[model samples]
Structure formats: structure tokens, C-alpha cells
Target: MSRRRSKILVVSALAVLLLAWEGAVVLTGAQASWPFPSGIIRSGFAITADGTLLVALAGSLQRVITGFLVGALVGIPTGIAMGLLPWVNLAMRPVTESLRSIAPIAWIPLAILWLGVQGNAALFVVAYAAVFPFILNAAQAARAVDRNHLRAARALGAGPGLILRAVVVPSTLPTIFTAARIALAIAWSSIIAAELALGVKIESGGRSVAGLGQLMVATLYVKRDVNALVFGMLVIGLVSFLIDAVLRRLRDTLLPWARR
Candidate 1:
């Protein structure tokens, strides 16, 4: 099938799946007090009545961006360095790989102890999540630079710095961008986990301090409010989808030459 047809089919399939899910719940007479789809829409509006949802989202986005920047700032350069220099890679590989093995959440306790389980702690986890993709892929991208190109540049009397700037960088740029996109998703998730851990002081509908994730978790435990959980899940998925789409557009624009 054509790509366009495939996409259309996928979307239709998703709609069907959603309908089936709601229908199944009703058919089984589950205890889930699922609000009608329209009610869910109203609830979304309720969440955003005075912009609390948007504010919380913005805060999370800001933290994610900052952490991603931190990771890329350190990871890209370090990855490139390691990729270019065998000695550096050999010296640091064990440490770097070892650290990557440790899950970002594992550091939560220490992060809270040192930085408090607040915005900074969340940012730290996201930054930590962002780093691995930067370093690992950048190193591989650098390594993938053709030996022929290197030889040609050297034969033309180009120095190491010039060869790197003119050849190595351009060739490896796609891989770096790819790694950045992957890291962006990781950073987003890490920030959400951070928010869940630290909790947001969101005020909504004349109420006060409605911790976004906390509220979702509360609804989840209420047992009857399964619809709320579904709604929250959809919200998160929609946000992540939009983010990934934006990054894909950026990748296409920034590196039109990026190979599939």
C-alpha cells in the first residue's frame, strides 16, 4: 500500500481501537465510571479554566528544555571527542558505559537530598537522561566518517582541525541530529517523571495546589474514575506526539540530507 494510504489506515485503526475500548467498558458493565467522551472534553477545559494546565505544561516544558540543553552541551562535545580520539574513548568508555547502566530514577533520592525534590532535581534527571544519546551516537557518527575523506583532506595538506571542521563535522551532523531527537523524547519523559516525583503546585478552578501528576494518580486510585486515567494518558500521549512531530520537522529542515 502507498504510504499515504497506510497512514490513513493507521489513524482509522486507532479510532476504532478507542471506540472498542469504550464499548468494551460499557458492555462489561465495568465499575469504571467513565465519563462520556464529551465529558472528558469538558474536563480538559475545566483543567485549563484559568490556564493551570497550560502553566504546568509550560513549566514542565521549560525544565525539559533546560535539561536537554545541558545534556547536549556536554554530551555532543564529549561524544565527538571520544569518537575522534581512540585514546579518549578507551580511557572513558568504561565509566561512561557504567553510568549509562544506572537508571535516571535511581538517582532521585540523592538528587532530592542534594538539590531537593523540586525543579532542579527534575532538571537534573532530564539532563542525565539526555546525555547518553548525545555521547553514544555522536561518537558513532564521528567514527563513521570515511577514511577516504580523511586521506583526501590530508593529501590536500588540510590540518587536523580543518579536516574535522570541514569534513568530520559535516558528515557526522546527521547522526548528531538523530541522537538529539531521540534524546529529546528521553528528556521529555525524564522531566515528567521529575514532575511526578517533585509534584507541581498547580492551582485550578479556585482550588489550590493541584499537583498535576498527583491529581492523575489520585483519580487512578479512586477506582471508579478510570476515565480520568484514560484522559490523562491521552493528554500525555498527545503532547509527546506533538513534540516528536515538531522534532521530525526540524530534522528534515535542518538536515535535508539525513538518510533514512
Candidate 2:
């Protein structure tokens, strides 16, 4: 199908889904138990106006950003080193392989035990989630750089630094960015889990240590507020979608030759 037709179809499907949901809610007379699409909108607006949503979003974003940066800073360089040096690869691969096989969420208990229920616990989890993909992808990408390109650059009297900048780094960038996209999603999801699992209690109603995940959990299980739960879920989905869209655009812009 054509792009325009595909988009229309998607929109149509969404509209149908929304309508079906509202119809079900009306038929069941369970507006309080299940949120209609309008309930989600109203809840979102109400929470935003009260500044509850903003605070949670900001706290979550801060942890995710910090964790992602730390993970990338550590993982990318280590991966490059491992890829470029046989000794480094031999030394690091076994440890990395062992650790990578373990799920990031599995470390949540340890993180909470080590760092307590505060922000640091969540940060640790998010960083752990973000690191492995970066390491694996960057190492593979760096290793996959054409040997002939390196030899040619060396033959032309190019230094290691020069060859790395001109050839190795450029060749590896696409894979790195791809890994980054995956890592970002992982980091985002991990932060939510961390926040829900280890969220600190705040005395203030509006100003809480709770992130969206916490809000979602509380709304559903504690408050039994389906509208609020739906709102939180929508916000999460929208933010994730936007971030992924931005990353895709950045990739396309930076790697224009990738299109060919």
C-alpha cells in the first residue's frame, strides 16, 4: 500500500478502537472501572494542571538521561577498545558475556539493597539496561570495519588516530546509533520498573518520588482509578514514540549515505 493509504488505515484503525472501547464502557455501565478515551484525556489534563504529571515526568526523565549517558560513556569506549585490541577482547569478552546473559531487571533487588529505595537504585538499573547493547553492537561494528580500508590508510602514512577518525569511527557509527536506539528503549523501560519497584515515599501529594510507573501502579491497584491509569499509560507511550521518532530522524540526517 501507498504511504498515505497506510497512514489513513492506521488512523482509521485507531479511531475504531477508541470507539469500540467507549461503546463497551457505555454498554457495561462501567465508566468508573474502565476508562473511556475521553476519561483518559480529562485525567491527563487534570494531572497536568495540578503539576503531578510534570513532576513525575521530570524525575523519570532526569534518571533516564543520567543513566543513559553514564552507560554510553562507559560502554562505547570499552567496546571500541575490545574491538580494536585482541588482548582487550580476550580479557573482557568472557566477563561481558556472562553478565549480559543476565537480565537487567534481575539486578533490581540488588540495586535496591545496595542503594536503597532512592533515585540511585533506579539509576543503577537504567544504566545496567542501557550498557550491554552498546557494548555488543559497538564491539561488533568496530571489528567489522574493512581490514582493507585500515591497510590502505596505514599504507598512505595515516596514523592510528587518523585512520580511526576517518574510517573506523565513521564505519561503526551506524551500528552504534542502532544500538543507541535499542539502549534508549531499554533504559526508558528500566527506569519505569525501577521507579515502580523502589519509589520513595513523599509526604506531599503533588510532589512525589513517584514516576509514571508508580503513578500507574497506584492509580490502578491503590486508587482504582482507571482513568488515571490510562492517562499514565498514554503518556508513557507518547513519550517513547516521540523519542524513537527523534532518534530515527537523527540517524537519517547524520547518515544520509545510509539511504543509498
TM-score of each: 0.81, 0.88
Cα RMSD of predicted structure 1: 4.3
Query: What is the lDDT for 2 in model 1?
Result: 100
Error of 2 at 92 (Å): 1.6
Clashing pairs in 1: none
Q: Quote the positional error of residue 202 for candidate 2 in Å.
A: 8.0
The residue-level lDDT of candidate 1 at 154 comes to 98
lDDT at residue 211 of model 1 (Cα atoms): 34
In model 2, what lDDT does residue 192 have? 87
184, model 1: CA deviation in Å?
Answer: 0.8
Deviation in angstroms for 252 in model 1?
1.6
- 1-260: candidate 2 lDDT, tens digit per residue: 99999999999999999999989998999997778988888888988999988888988898899999988998998998888889999999999999988888788888878986667888999999899999999999989989999899999999989988999989999999998999999899889877776543322234344577666656655577788887888888888898899999998999976543
Residue 170 local lDDT, model 2: 91
